[model samples]
Target: AQSVAQPEDQVNVAEGNPLTVKCTYSVSGNPYLFWYVQYPNRGLQFLLKYITGDNLVKGSYGFEAEFNKSQTSFHLKKPSALVSDSALYFCAVRDIRSYIPTFGRGTSLIVHP
Candidate 1:
């Protein structure tokens, strides 16, 4: 079985400081990893994906993630946080042949001024 875990329920960061939201996964086969962001009362927006090749993948709004196969982890990162960046984030993963992806419970990112 494949699954993803987002240990933190929320992350608090200053507007100008860097931020990170942790993620870990378990899969039977090669996994397609993804990160999505959701604002209040809105659907999730695709932030990035890791299919193959590069370990470091960049995404929208200056967000990036590193795919570590050995550790079975893919953590989201940003050098500078913004007040507008405050939202909920979800980490997802799917097997190569699976159409339905499993998502983490979600992590609330609060960027303060």
Candidate 2:
């Protein structure tokens, strides 16, 4: 079974500081990893993905993620944090043969101004 884990329930960072949200996964085969952000009362917004190619993948809103095959991890990172960046972040993983992706419990990012 494919599974994803976001170790921290919450991550706190000061505005303008770098930030990271951790994630790890377990899959039976090749894995497709994804990161998403959710605002209050809003749906999930795609952030970045790791399907192939470079280990570092960039995505919308200045967000990026690094895929590490050996560690089975795909942690999201931002060079700097903004108050507007505060939200719930989720990590998901899907096995190549599966149609559904397994999502983490989501980590709440609190960017203090």
| Top model number, TM-score | 2
Model 1 over residues 30-91: C-alpha lDDT tens digits?
A: 99999999999999999999999999999999999999999999999999999999999999
Clashes of 1: 0
What are the lDDT figures for the candidates, one per model? 0.97, 0.97
- Which pairs of residues collide in candidate 2? none
Q: Give all TM-scores, in the order shown.
A: 0.98, 0.99
Candidate 2 stretches with Cα past 4 Å from truth are none
lDDT per residue as tens, model 2, 1-113: 99999999999999999999999999999999999999999999999999999999999999999999999999999999999999999999999999999999999999999
Q: How big is the positional error of residue 38 in model 1, measured in Å on the Cα after superposition?
A: 0.5
Question: Which residue pairs in model 1 clash with each other?
Answer: none
